[model samples]
Structure formats: C-alpha cells, structure tokens
Target: MTTNAELAARFEEFADLLEADDVEYKPRAYRRAAENILAHPVPIAEAVESGDEDAIDDIEGVGDAISSKIVEYVETGKIEELEELRAELPVDIADLTRVEGVGPKTVGVLYRELGIETLDDLEAAAEAGEIQEVKGFGAKTEQNILENIDFARTVGQRHLVGEARPLADDVLAYLEGIAGVERCEVAGSIRRWRETIGDVDVLAATDEPDAVVDDFLAWDSIDDEIESGPAKASVRVGEMRVDLRLVVPGEFGSALQYFTGSKGHNVRLRNYAIDRGMKLNEYGAFDVSELEADPDADPQHVGGGQRVGERVAGETEESMYDALGLPWIPPEIREDRGEIDAAEAGALPDLVTEADVRGDLHTHTEWSDGNNSIEEMVAAAENRGYEYYGVADHAQGPGVVGGMGLSEAEILDQVDEIRAIDDEYDVHVFAGIEANVDAEGAIGLSDEVVDALDLIVASPHSALDQDAETAGERLIRAIENPAIDVLGHPSGRLLNEREGLAIDAGALGEAAAANDTALEVNANPRRLDLWGSAVQAAIDEEAKIAIDTDAHRPATLEFVRWGVHTARRGWAEPNDVVNTWELPDLESFLH
Candidate 1:
C-alpha cells in the first residue's frame, strides 16, 4: 500500500528534479505541497484511488497541477512528468544532494559539466582532480566534498525519532491488545529520545513467546518479515525496521536495562559491577564474589543466561540499580558521561520532563504560516493545563517563506487578538515574535516592533554557513539584544536535511549567560537544535534554557515532549528552564 510518506517522497523528488533544472518558483511550490502532503492526516494515494474529491481538496498547498500529478501517480504508479525530468537530469539527485555543500543546482552543474551521475562518479572526479578545474569550483570546495562524501556515503539511514516513536506507539498498542502480552515498552535510541534512530526496539514480557511471536508476525503494519524465532522477531515496517523480543516477566527489567543502552553506559556499568564483585547483565544482578572462576563460561549474562550466581535482583529496573547502591538513571542521561558517578554521589539532577513544561514560548497561528487561529491555539494550551502560553509567529525576516511572515502592522494587530484571547481562555497568552537574525547579527525588527512584542525570539534563518567563530559571534549578538528573550533553534539545523552551522556552544553560552537571554531548545523533532551536547555546554555556562515546541498548530503543541527529553539529555532541571517557572516568574523573565 502507498503510504502518505511515500506520496510525499514522490513530490519531494519532483521538487528536487525541478530545482535541478533551475525551474525557480515551481520547486518551492512543489516542496510546500510535499510538506502538506506529509503532514496531512489522511492517505492521499487512497483518496486519489477511491475518487475522494473532498479529501484531495482538503490537503493544503496542493494546487490543481500538483493534484493532477497525484492522480496520474495513483493510477499508473508513476508520474510521467517526473520520469521525463529524471531522464533529462540523469543524475542521482537525492544521494548527490545529500553530500554537504551539494544542492540540486550543484547536481545539475556537476552533471552538465563533468558527467558526475553517481557517488562513484563524483568520487572518481574528485580523486582525478577534475572537480577543481571547473569554473566557480575551488580546491577547498573539492576538499569539503571529499570530506563529506564519506559521511553521505556511509552515514546510517536512520529514521527520524518523530516518525519512529509514533510507529512504536502503534506497535505497543497492538501488542497490548494481544491475549497473553503482559507489558510492552520501546527500548534503544528511541527510548532515549535520540534525534534519529536505526530501528524501533520493542520489548514485551510474555510466558508464551511463540504465541506472541506469531501475533507479532501477523501484525498488519509489517511490510516484510526479516526473521522470526520463538522468543524474538524482526519485521520491516515501511522504511523502518522493528525488532521484537519477548522475555519472561521476571527478566523484563534486566532485559530493558541491557537493551536500552548507549553502549558506553552499559560498559562502564558492567565495570562498576565488577569492581563491586557483583555481576550485572540482561539476566539480573548477581553476587559473584563467592563463585569460583569458570574459565570456559561467560561471566556476564548480557546475552541472556539464567541465575549465573546467587541472583540478587532482576524483577525491576529500580531493583537492578538498587542492587548496585545507585538510583535508576533516566535513559537520556545513560551516555556514561558522569551520570553513573552522579548517581553514586546522590547528586543526579532532577531532570526536566514533559509535565515540567508549563507552556511553549515559540508557536504560530494563521497570522503567519500556521494553520489555526490564535484562539484555537490558546484553547489548545488551556486544554494542556498550561498556566500561560505564548504565540510567537514568524516575523518578517530573512529566510522566512514569502508571504508567510508578519509585517510590523500585522504584528501589532495580532497582539491585540492575543490579548483578547488571553482574557477569554484560561491560559494567559503572551504576544511574541520570532524575529530573523541576518548574517551580520542584525535583527530584522525595528525598535517599535520589538517593543510591541511580549517576547522576542531571534533566530538565524539565512547564511547559516558561517565559520565556528563567526556563527558564535552572530548568535552572541542576537542574544545580547535586550529585546530578544530567547535564541530559537540556535544552530538552525534540520536533522538529516542539513548541518546548519558549526558553532562554538561554550562561547554562545557564556555570552547568553551574561546577557540574560535564554537559549531555546527547539522541540520540533527536525530542528532539535542546541541538541544534548550543545545544550549541556550552555547549561554548564549557567545559561537559561527555553524548551519550546515551535508548533504551527494546536496538535503540534505536544511536540514539547521531544524538547523536554532533549533538555533532559542536556541534564536540564526544572529551575533551569523558564517555562517550568510559575506564571508570574515566567512573565518577569520574559519581560
């Protein structure tokens, strides 16, 4: 079956091919349509096939031309126009473009100039020194291509956490409905809320392994069965892989601990256990101090062996940690980066969670590119039990989509609507704007416009290819502006799409701390900029953090969960994040 993602991917290809040909305006239109198609709540392919006109029309940004192509694709499993574009270009647009500093136009240039159609071709050209000889190409550019080509070639094709987590939820829901499944939870990088994950690892506790495996294989979402066994199964779900492991309820906790690992953390933890003369593994914690050395056997039951020594704990994760005289570590902090030491010292941070997020400071409405009205968004915040809410739609600035950002007059008008909404809704609404910071570190808004906003989130939208020192200076300048309350998505990154900038987090953090500006941890899964390591650096410098969803609509407000976990990954506590403050305190901070 053709999924929404598959349909969206087709449109993305159309956009890329169009851009490669230097067809200016249509490419952006197609890309916008592609985003809408990806975000649309229904199956577009099914709508085209079933002749559901209303469903097709309901998709935003899809003009008649795009819709006709969709119809053609649904009917014939191919778009004739796209095929023609592909044939004309005759290049691996996606893979070639994945190389850092390579774009669709560059792909066109490379193809027309040097006949570079594949990774191998590009590598051969670069190696033969043919690339630098081309007009507008330099030795440095060639070197960078050489540097990034390997990553683009060898980088694991990981699924976005935002996409994978929901699929895991669906799998969990299905497993919960089974006859004998006791408990089920996701493990691995997804469990730790990493930006991208290799696969969805699900652990289910069940005495009836064969029955559970049979039902898992029977799951409707499975696109292909990779492998199946009595206690475990691996299945292909769309582009992602799902691995299911069934264990007896007693071993569930230990198994989860072992599998939900950063690898380094588990290694350090095993060492800790060894130093204590205890053994820790997927099986359980055992007192091995009294046991004689068995040279032929595995000392660590990491691969599932039962009762290696006098078993001390295994039934619960808490018990597993308690057996080591340490508290259970949150998965986000399980990178072996002093978390175990912190645990042993009883100094582990009270990390921020989704519930700790009282409101989102960065969001949008119909006044900008967002789909909903200000009232609808406020109502959604009220539903979430927020003490206060903020709507900082995109302000007129560099990098904003044309006709999508608000002018000075429009910004003031929206503030009025937001004030009224604040009175009507239970949640106090703050009028805000996400102003654009240009390459030279100047804000787009005037003084009057900045004063009108209750909060100002200045973010870089253009010229993100600055050097580390230059990017840091630009960000520091943005934060130093008294009107700017938060620096949103500090790096302007779109995970797997682009590496936005090379930034000196420590320098930016120090400047932000001195300026009293909060560094935002953007929660949109794609732009979880100021990721764990960067956020940690900023927090270490005593900079305040703002965890925001950057939501476009009400339903997207829940994206804060991703942000919260990301903040947790940086060792953020409730007090470190402004939104977790009391309403009055947050107001004071923003002002």
Candidate 2:
C-alpha cells in the first residue's frame, strides 16, 4: 500500500534534490505533480494499482514519467530515481525548510558551504558563528536560523483539519463502494472538526467483516498495514494513520457513539447511564441493574455482560441518548464542557453554519499578495451567491515592506476599480484594506485612506512576541479605533510555526464588545486565529464575531466553513456572526 501523501512527499523530495543539483525543467514538473497529487480527490496509488495508465496520467500536472514512477512505488514501495536523488542530496530537506526563512536554495547553499544536513548541525553552526563566514550568508540570517529553530522543533506532527478532511472523504468514498458495506463514516476528532488531528478513524457497518477488512487493507492509498483483525484494521496512508472498525448493523449506532469520543465526554456519559441504572457500551444501551454482575470485576469485563434487560436503543445515536433521557449532543461540544447540562436544560445554542454566512469580509486580490485579480475574486463571490464580498488587500506597513501591500495611491485607485466591479455584479463589493496594527495599536493607513474604504480589518503583523498584558492592551487599542470594523487573525499564529502573541482573550473580547468592533476567526487552516476558546471568551462578553476566510483566492472562499465551525466551537450562534446577517443589516452594524 502506497498513500498519495507518501508518494507526493517522494515526488517533492525529487523536486528538491533536482533543484539543489540545478536540474531545471524536471524539478518544476516534479513539484507540479506533487501538488496535484496531494490535492487529488482519490489516492494516487489507487489509480496506479488499478493498472489504468490512462487514469493515472489523467491526474492534473502528472505526466507519463511521473505516473510510471507512482506505479513503480505502489507496486514495489520504492522509486529508483527518487532513491538516487535522495542519495545524491542526502540532506534533511523537510526539517531544514521548516525554519522560517530557509528554503531549498538555502539548504543547498548551507549544505554545500558547511555540510549542514540537520537542524542540530545548523544550530551548532549558527551558535559557533561559522554560518556567517559562508559567502551569501550573513550574521542576521544566521541569528534568525538560531532563533526560529527552537520554534520549529516545538512544531508538532499533527495534520490540520483542512489537510486531513479530504483524505477522510476519500476513504469514506472508497469504503462505500465496497460490496456489503451498509454504512461508513469518519469518527473521532475529525467528526468534531478539531483544528489538528493525530490520525483518522472510520467506522463501517457490515455483516461481512472479513471482506471489509480485506478490502480496506488492499486500499490503493495504504502505505503499510499496521494491524488487521476480524473487526478492526489500522493502516498507514500517506502521512496519516487511518483506523477502520466494522460492527453489525444492529450495533452500529452504539459503536459510532463509543468510537466518536472525547474520552471525557464518554466518561461523563457512562456516569449518566449508571445514574439511570442503565449500562451503555459499544453494543447498545441496556437495563442491566436487574441482572447479577460482580461489582469487583474489571470495568471492561463489566461492560461485556449479557444483554439481559430491555434493549432500549442500539440502532441510532439519537435513540441511544433518548433512552438515557438526554437529547443527542452535537459532537463538537461533547468535551463534557457543559454540553450535557445544556442538553438537560434544553439550552444548547443553535450553532452557526456554512449556510448562515452571507459574505466574506477579509479577502485579497492582485492588488496585494493574492494571485487573482479584482474581477476574478468578485466573480468568484458572485458565483457563491453571496450578498456581499469585502476586498481587503494588505496596506503598506511594518510587516508588509516587500511590496506586498498597497501604497496609499494604489489603495485609492483600487477603490475605484472595486466600485466599478460592484456596479456590474449582483454582489455588493466592499472596497477595504487589511491595515496593520503597529506596536502602539495605531493603524498604518491615513484617516483619508481608511475613510475611503467601506470596511477595515486591522491586524497585528509584526511585534507578535509581546508579553500577555501588552498584547491585550495593544489589541484593545486597535479595537477602540473608530475606523476599524474587524480585528483579523488576532493572535497572528501559524498552526505549528510561530506562537504569535500571548494576550488576555477575555479582556480583548470585552474591549471589542465595547468598541463595536468584531473579532475575526481567520479561517485559513494555518491560522484559525481567535480559536475556539478565545471565541468562547469573546462570546461571553457579547462581542460580535465575523467568520472570515482571510482568503487570497476564489477557491479558498469555501474555507468560510472552517471559520464558521470554529465559531460554533466557541459557542457562537448565527446572531453572533456579523457576516451571517443580511446586507442592509450588516452595513448598519458596520457603520
């Protein structure tokens, strides 16, 4: 079994090795193939295993040579060309590249200059002051490497939900196609849409457990089989480990409940069951107090008791909870964090959903760092049937020195272009700027520039390492700005890269509430910035929230769901999100 992720990594390495060796066109081809493979809906290995050369070649950006290599890897778990390239470069490309400013070129240069192959070697060279001695490497570059290496080391191996979700969907699609498979679904933290996931868990209901297990083991994307049994199998695919379990149709509901757990939630649920003299386990909910069972027996064994009492529920999760006299709880809030109590009181908040979002308030176009032009981005929004779309390109400021942000003149010119586009489309196009908030919480742009825009998303770009109190005060000052409508990616954290800022979230939320500024949940997977807990704190203070994608491209606008769900995790309802409101209503609120 060879997963798309593993194959893509090999191709990426091939590209890196080629670049280090200065092999031109082939490297681009390899990189393109790798990107396409990762984004492919199904596992690349599956097409290869199907012996369908046409299907393999049909993958976007994949040519005959790459397809052949993919087939070779799937069949033999190795690619000779990649192996040769690895032997030639023999550098820790991935680890080195994780450092903030390091890239393949840097890696090649450092390796050629000082034989640096690992982070330890890089760190030692930097500490010894030897790296600055190399041509093209300066003292500052060396210092940055030293400073960021520790942050890189702390970066975990967990995959973001954005990355893991498609893989899970692919697995589910594959399982559903198997004969005798009655139902299949992904479980665990994935179901709850946790920002990062350790691995993927899937459950299926079928009488043919053996057949299901065999089919799963033979999945085209499997890199290696970890373990396989009659009812369960775990396999490694790409960079993710996928575990599958099979249960009888009658027990499917109970199994889903047991497996889709935040352990704390299940523990509390078991306690609730006991209080009602009911036994709840993977098999089903049963009235077991009347039956004789040893109190001193192991808990695992206790759950294995005979189905002696009434079979209250087993076929559905709702029924399982209904039998316990509790409403079915949504998985996202099942962390035993007052969800049970809320369910008891019939007070669960109606979570905001993707459908509730009427617009995206923070996006970019060619005017800034985004790839698409203004017309393209607005067209994309109109296609999504949005009532409004905010074009908030980066404003020239502290962290935007690289010509990535618009000058005042450029911003003014773009406003005219946006107004022109707005006249043509059904969607109300908002001309806005994502202005930088400096150390003292002053917006980077002038009053005239801010006044010209329909919206403003002020964000902290530099000086992200401030102490908690300073950070909180800084954000509060930004929120207090009358021109600012939203605070974007408040923490400025990238998932596993930088820690961003440490702030008192409650205080920040309170200040935002007072100032009528909405706090944003930046939905870009890398920065789900005002994460769930922070969102909760903000909601507690009745602060308005805006679930914006911070999208730079049209395809990425769909990322709104990530922000919407993150808001839900924070206990936000539709009314809490300004983007969920009608256009006239939202405009009034913004003013």
Find the candidate with the highest TM-score and give its number: 1
Query: Can you give the TM-score per candidate against the true fold?
Result: 0.88, 0.84
Provide the global lDDT of candidate 2 against the true structure.
0.84
- lDDT (10s digit) by residue, model 2, range 1-591: 565667777888888788877777787678767756754556666676667788787776787788888888888878998888778778988777767667687888888889999989999999999999999889988887898898777665777787778789889988999997999888999888788888899999999999989988887667689999999999887778899989999988988998898899898888888777788888888886666566886433344554546678988888889998888888877777788888888989899989999999999987887757999999989999899999999998887634589989999999999999999999999999999999989997787897899999999998876778898888899999999999999998877656688877788889988989999999987788888878988989989999998876676787886788788878889999999999989998784
**Model 2 misplaced stretches (Cα beyond 4 Å):** 1-90, 97-115, 120-154, 291-310
RMSD of candidate 2 to the true fold?
4.4
lDDT of 2 at 351: 91
Report the alpha-carbon TM-score of model 2 versus the true structure: 0.84
Cα lDDT tens digits for candidate 1, 1-591:
355656677888888888888888888778768767766655576677788877877776777888898888767768999999989999987778878778888888889999999988998898888999989998988877877777676533876687778678878988999998998999999998898898899999999999999988887667789999999999987667899999899988989999999899999998999788789888888988777766666666432355767889888888889999999999999987799999999999999888888888999888887878888888888899998888999888788965588889999888888877778877888999988989988886878877878999889988877888888888888888888899999998777667787887778889888988999999987788889888888889999999998887666787787889899999999999999999889888875
